[model samples]
Target: MDTEAVNNARHGLRLLLVTLLLTSIGFFIYYVYRQALPKPLPGIPCDEVAAKKVLGSLPSMFSHWKQHGVVMPWLTGHNLKHNPPLVQFFGAPFAQPTVILSDFQESQDILLRRGKECDRADRTLQSFEGMIPHHHLAMRTNGPRFKGNKELVRYLMSPKFLHEASAVQIYEKSLALIDLWSLKVKTSGGKPFPARQDIFDAALDMVSGAAFGFKDDLSITKRQLNHFLSNGVKFKEHENGSVDFHGFLFFGYIVAGHETTSSSLSWALKFIADHQTEQDKLRQALWEAFPDAAAEKRVPNVKITTTHVPYLDGIIDECMRLETSQTKITVGSWSVDDMHLFKPERWLKTGDSGELVYDS
Candidate 1:
């Protein structure tokens, strides 16, 4: 090559290298500055492991479960010690802050009284977008749109509507589930088998029966998208491309209903399995409540009058109490009962003030 041409090429290469080096240095300095920036608020900092982002903390900011599935209640059990309404921060840089409300009255005022002042976060809605990308109850924060969506669901869930459209479906599905479980247990030779899938399948069947009348596929149709509650509840951006708004909402119920119930049942089963005496008590309560519905045999015609069954009620409540700890929110349990037994009578007791001191 000619001398001038070679010289020019070398100069260009040096310039490019210098540019890249300067850019790298600038990025590093910017990252350091962001890390040094003051947190969103002064609170008890946690999860120093989370990534730094404007959309920090992801799911933990909404509740207790972090990106790595760690429940952040390492800050728990300090209710009387720390005097909550304590603020705790999670994540890095643009950290998501959480307030732990240990007081009942304060919680009531914030959750029930001043609900309008506190709107749901956007990223939380966005998290559900993969299931219900378009507008649905989970995605809506506030305003008339959220109101209409909730009202429609509330009406559909009303006793009258449920009795007419859904009760029969639930009953039949449940009976069929009992049969399936009977066969499963028999095949297991009375050994413990994984019940998660069975429970999940049953949930899927029940929710599908109620929501879509047993239609399996939920691919979107234009007609479905034009429904009144069809809009996008975006978190950061609309990079999710396109989805039929109506089908999004409908399918969301199918997925979420199954997930929530199945997860709850799994947790309940674990707790119950650990407490065999309570499980026996529950079985006794069940048989007494429905003489026709047997475990090994086909359960015929369960009366659904379970509200009158005390032991069963207690077992269910206790299961939920333990299961909620998985959510990792720090809160106290206030009940007058022997904490050991799966006793339901503890739920019925009154405190010294002649009032029930129920704590969530």
Candidate 2:
């Protein structure tokens, strides 16, 4: 009687333990599957294939980026895939999907009219805060920190400050770039050389001088140009036919501005080089605007250049539109046939006085 009772009790206890373990495993699996599933926002279109996977759109995005060296095109391509103006995609596992609003007019309206309803994303604020803790970009629009930062930097954007204090520094820095390019031309014997670093250095110099009151002698472009001129240094050509020069790097807001400005300038130069006709027209327009400077065979001053040179303005506007540095949410209208073309004339039109004027 004792042996039979003991064996039966042990078997029952073992069965109970196995049942509890199986139930726990089942609950864990369900929880993970729930987390892995895509959670799309109401009324937003999403990729069906992505919704079936744990990683969602990330795998596709990474594949596209690996092939193209960029993710924006693939991100924006969602607009073409869906008929709706708004689309959502999962950026990470178990994370909320990011909504992409492609309509330009609606996006503008939301940004301008719905400021209170739609505050800056917490993720973006946190990211910026990590890098620039006290900067306005890291704060919410309604916060005191943001308002104080705005007040501090407001004068930087003012017409008087920009035209007087900033313009002078930028003008001086630009001249250094011209001199650097001239030296490069001489050293390279009119052969093509990479100008990305030179452009970046010039941009940094301009920003540092304008923002922090740095002197011309402290400029990166000026220093590099001086080194090349004094040392009789020549550009080292690579096997790929690209030429290289020495450059230095530094790290904040200044770096951010420098990067954006340099990228735009680099794209502008590439566009201008590819379009010889537009380049010639731009040169003529500049010369016509600054007849005295052209006649003297010298570059025009900041004030003169800042004045309404329609062609120059058009070129700049076109370049910025063609290759935007920032990853913006809105997409422009697809109605225009020549939208892809780099035509500066697209931004130009005849004024009431029948003269060429800058029109966006």
Tens-digit lDDT track for model 2 on 1-360?
999999999999999989999999999999998888888887788998998888999999999999999898987787789968889998888889998887555666787678788888888887777656676767789987778775766666678877887789889998988998988898888998889878887887787777677786678887787778777965432221222211111124464567787888898998899999999999999899989999999888887636889999889877766764533333334346877788887778999999999876
lDDT of 1 by residue, 72-173 (tens): 453453233455455444444543455566544355456555657865556667677666655564554565577666554566557775776566666766
Judged by lDDT against the true structure, how good is candidate 2? 0.78
TM-score of each model, in listed order: 0.60, 0.78
Clashing pairs in 1: none
Once model 2 is optimally superposed onto the true structure by TM-score, how far is the C-alpha of residue 91 displaced, in angstroms? 1.7
Scored against the true structure, residue 43 in model 2 reaches a CA lDDT of: 76
